[model samples]
Target: MTPEHWLNIATHGLALEAAARVRAEYLAHLEDALEAGESAEAVLREWGDPHTANRELSKAHLTTREARYLPAGYAPTWAGLGRALGEDAVPLLLFALTALAELRSGETAITLALLLAIVAAALLRWLVLSRQMLAARGRATLYWLLSFPTVLMAMSCAVLASRGAEGWHEAGRLLWERGWTGLLIVAYLLYHFSRLLTALSAARKAEAQL
Candidate 1:
């Protein structure tokens, strides 16, 4: 393959800056090989399959999607804080709405406490993710903690499902009684679960790089 075609394949899905860096490094290597009287085809062949190279490079560096979760601390600006808040805004809003709905149903003290706890946990998570340069294991642990509620919800659903018709009836009754509040909670949990899954993938890639 031509150098350009090989590079395009090998750097596919990387951020522009990361792709540029890889391109520069590989081009330099190619040039040195040519200077040493190596045939272009021979050098390219030595580099092996572009698809395998792409996979290895992707694991060693953040892809465009995974890079979205990275804190914008490259230059230290207010943008980092904005990005972090934006990442968390939806989940926090959903939780707040759920708490408000529950409060209206006469569980004043408990609802208020739950809301406060949710807010505190979210703020703490945001602070850690955006401000700290945590190791891969640390990031995975944090994400797992954040995902614990979703895990419990899944287990609860499994238990209910195992109970057959009676379990299904109890689930329907709970949903019917809770109405929109239940929906908001479910949405929040699902969103958290998605983040957890993404973090797990990103963390594994990061650990591979290390």
Candidate 2:
């Protein structure tokens, strides 16, 4: 049978998200088989009955918690953040607790730092998880959004490392008190933005070749 025929039967009772992944995987397998000189019939015979395969695949898919966290598909930026939170729930909770502690102790800088860290983490997680579902341009956009904070962090590191021991101490102090750390965050973000653009350019080239 053709790959589409198998896919239709295999995905018959599956949810949209699960079906998409199964379809993609099956298509890849079909590609490999065809490339290896195997006939469609042979591939079908080796792959087994689509209905049976779908049942088995669906069983595993339905049992997973990950599907609830970040199922495949594109979403708006806000939804992406929700997915990221779901995916990294435990770590985020811990970070929240730390931030709260810092706040209670009047460590505004530390609290702000923690909050920024969470934002960065959220952005990174969303980009990584959702990139596949995104178009090449969307993927590039998300990466660009991520680069801004990264650039800031890198710059802050550079500034902190710029001088001798005394200068290092001074710079470090200035980073928090003078709000240079905030600048650092901004720099980091810009850097990620640039990286995303670079990746997008590469993807465009690759697509052009195709």
Candidate 3:
């Protein structure tokens, strides 16, 4: 394949800045080999398969999603913050509203306290992800922290279902009690959890490659 074509395929999923840097480095290497009297075909052959290079490069660099979470400096831009937290924040907000509706009037304080705790956990996650280049162990810890709310919600649903000893019918009732907001929260948390796991797996694979 042509150098341009190979580079394009190899840098497909990387962030823009990372793709540019990889392209420049590879181009320079190609130029140096040409100056040493190597044929273009030989140089390309030495580079191996572009798809293989693409997978390795993707593991080593920040993805577009990951890049959005990286802050510019001491103070991150509003746009960046919004993009990083939008998926998470919206679900948390809905959970808070629905939780308040679910609890009795006297238990409003409990709902508020629970909401604050969840929000704090989420902010801590954002701070670490933005500020640190986490290793696999760190990613594991983050995954558990993010999973806390999901676990709690699942346990609550289980308890509700067990109350009637009616199985799936009771589970359906539980959902009705919480409304669509509950489903959204569960769906978002599961999606986010899977994303974190995928990232952790990628990081481990990259380290293995190194």
RMSD of each: 6.3, 12.4, 6.1
Model 2: lDDT to the true structure: 0.62
Best by lDDT: 1
- TM-score of each model, in listed order: 0.60, 0.33, 0.55
Off by over 4 Å in 1: 16-18, 69-105, 147-198, 207-210
Write the residue-wise lDDT of candidate 3 on 46-147 in tens digits. 999999999898877756665543333212455544544453676568768877687765567645655665666555555665654676546554645554
Of the candidates numbered 1 and 2, which has the greater TM-score value? Answer: 1
Candidate 2: list runs displaced more than 4 Å.
1-73, 77-79, 87-91, 120-138, 144-202
TM-score of predicted model 3?
A: 0.55
- TM-score of decoy 2: 0.33
After TM-score superposition, the amount by which residue 160's alpha carbon in candidate 3 deviates from its true location, in angstroms, is: 8.6
Candidate 1 lDDT over residue span 1-210, tens digit each: 798899899999986766888899999999999999998898889888999999999877768887665433321345644654454566557756777787757765644554455455545556676656687757666645643364346456777889988998988788778989878876887887676677667767656655
- The deviation in Å at residue 147 for candidate 2 is 6.9
- Clashes within 3 Å, all models in order: 0, 18, 0
Using TM-score as the measure, what is the rank order of every candidate, best first? 1, 3, 2
Which residue pairs does candidate 1 place in steric collision? none
